[model samples]
Target: MSKEDPKTNSGYERTLTNAHIQLIALGGTIGTGLFLGVGNSIHQAGPSVILIYIIVGIFLYFLMRALGELVLSDLHKHTYIEFIEKYLGKNIGFITGYLYWISWISLGMAEMTALGIYFQYWFPHLPTWVPGLITIVILLFINLLSARLFGNLEFSFAIIKIVTIIAFVFLIAYLLVTGGKTSFGPVGFGNLAKNGGFFATGANGFLGGFQMVIFSFVGVELIGLTAAEAQNPKVTIRKAINELPLRIILFYVMAILAILLVIPWNKIATTSSPFVQALGATGIRNAGSIINFVVISAAVSSTNSFLYSAGRLIFSVTYDGKGKWNETFGHLHRQLPQNGLILSACLMGLAPLVIILIGNQAFNFISSTSTSMFLIIWCLMILTHLSYRKQTPANKLTDFQMPQYPWLDYLTLAFFGLMIILLLSLPANRMAMISAILIFIILWAVSKIWHQERAI
Candidate 1:
């Protein structure tokens, strides 16, 4: 493929339709975090968990808007790394790119691990590593073969997730109206405050739930990464970002409200999936199996998204001359970065075996480390946008200016900082924070060396 070839030079297939893009975003953001982690969040915030999701949704909306604005103004076939490089200097871009790559790689591992756990429900005889390995191989092949295939697979996964959540909402409503085994008698809006009243756990509870709520919103920005591949980048990007708030409200807020109303918040289990437990509480015997399937789909979607993201992040770094632009890896075959895809698959497949060897506790530690790193990446992105705005001449800002300019960007950065402080203050998260800081320092040093070498 010639550098000038319209198809290959564009770096990805413009094969992702608006539906595919929206579904992929939905699949990517609404994952096990909502299905499984919500219980713990509810435990922390009680009914106020609803407010936590809303607050995070608002911030995430602003973040996506900033990203959409940036991508539209510079219509290069560029990834987020390219944006960082263009706006924050090459060194910073290089560091941010690699950090993101590592972050997603680790996240892919975490998703696979969760998949293995979910699979264990039906196939107790099967070792967790077996399913984990199989998932990695299948997704890797799909991603490597064609970008369109991956998009289609993700689209299907997204549909299953969306439909399931919607069904769950309806089921909860129906059960609440019909009454359950216990003489709950038409579980209504009163459930929101009946047990302990709204803010049942108080202000500290809301603050504690914020971290997990933010985690649920982790992959919402994935649409920005897919911009270079969207069939209509400009239109799709705007629609996807703009619809983020509604998606959060429908999927996270309303869904949780349904769960709490159907099953008392105090009764929600922290270890098991809230969805499953909530349904079971309503005397739905097969609820566990049903939720398992939904969660498995959610995990697969997350792994697929992470795999796609990992490949692009690595490819973007290569394009910027930070890594070898392996002809095989960066080249688009059937509108896919084949080598990058294969590499990501192999790494994810290997992660489970490596984790098993180290034990479950070690795997959990690594997962926490990855989450912390992602928070850092988010902070860097917001800061990079702030710097981009300041350095960009006022006259040039018309094309893609961040709304409220420095103020919104600054506010987002501050929130990110506060989250980091929370992470550091929490004893369990301290190790992850230290690890992330060390990784950042190492990347910063490497960037310095790379620049010096290039200057010579």
Candidate 2:
């Protein structure tokens, strides 16, 4: 593919392939939380947490398909923000674009913090912030050097995660065949309906799982962002979008099932890594060490993905006059937005230091705040897709139109709305909800001020 101008942030080398794109999506979606945190969801909803993943995965599949359609319609339009601007009004586009950029930055910070925590497990004597700073520096260097290098790093990170998961699955199957101390014999599927009687937490439990389960799918749409950088946009986009749903089901559903089955729902502890607990139950001697390595890799890969996306989002917003930042922030080196990448990396490293100075409670507060911001961005994406579909000509929508168009779109919107309602009702999430709204208001006011000055 011919390169476009780097000055306008219109072009970059297309270096990613279909496999790279696929693993990128996998890395983004499957994080440490799913491997370690789903126990909380299980505690809340019992075996029915599986059902929640299925439902959310379906809607997200359609949402991504809708986004893919827009991406495929125009190869040059790499970011979803650009699509929003072309189809929706400029104001909505600007807000969505900036909100997304800020949300990802916050997420990158949180992931970096999580990385520090993971590192603490290995080296308790070292200060936590030390590792966080080191991680940021390493990722910045990789991201700044070249887009292809970043892709390769991410690709390898993703492969580590994928291989770990596949190994876990095989181990689970072997445990089932070997016949453990439990009465279910060699191969048991009874875990699905036995303990807590499957849906033990009842309807409310399923509703509660929706909160975090949705969060797990946070960065799946990032595949669209790779369009401009993929070797062949048309082929890569179609292949990635087509396989997303199956990947979600296999990677999420099956893995969670293996976890819950290996250890009873009630017995699993949310505070500890579920992978470690599950492997331990299977009588594996070095399970803890193995799981630690996997979780650490998970945290690093997630942070890397977030940093990449945040940089690109910022570059896009600044190029479009949606944000006030240095023009050099949009500059590319080796087909990557080096300035943006470095800036985001610095902020992420700074987050842990800010938290340590403030307190653990303050750190937790920022993490919650970031989650709420992510929810708002997700809701905006669905809404933007809805508006884009309405404005798009029906005849020209054939490239990769969302299956079950308006109905799926409406249902997805309703699902996100209910999630917001859930957030409002829960005391733990109330601060996050309010903080996100305030951020949106502040961004809107700033946009207004910028527009007024430009008109003069």
- The candidate scoring highest on lDDT is 1
Q: lDDT for every model?
A: 0.77, 0.74
lDDT per residue (tens digit) for residues 77-195 in model 2: 75898878776666767787778887777766666665665665568676656666787788887787777777888889888888888888877877677755332233356777676
Per-residue alpha-carbon lDDT of candidate 1 for residues 157-242, written as tens digits (9 for 90 to 100): 88988998899899877766776442333567777877788899887777777666766777788898887777777677787887
TM-score of each: 0.91, 0.91
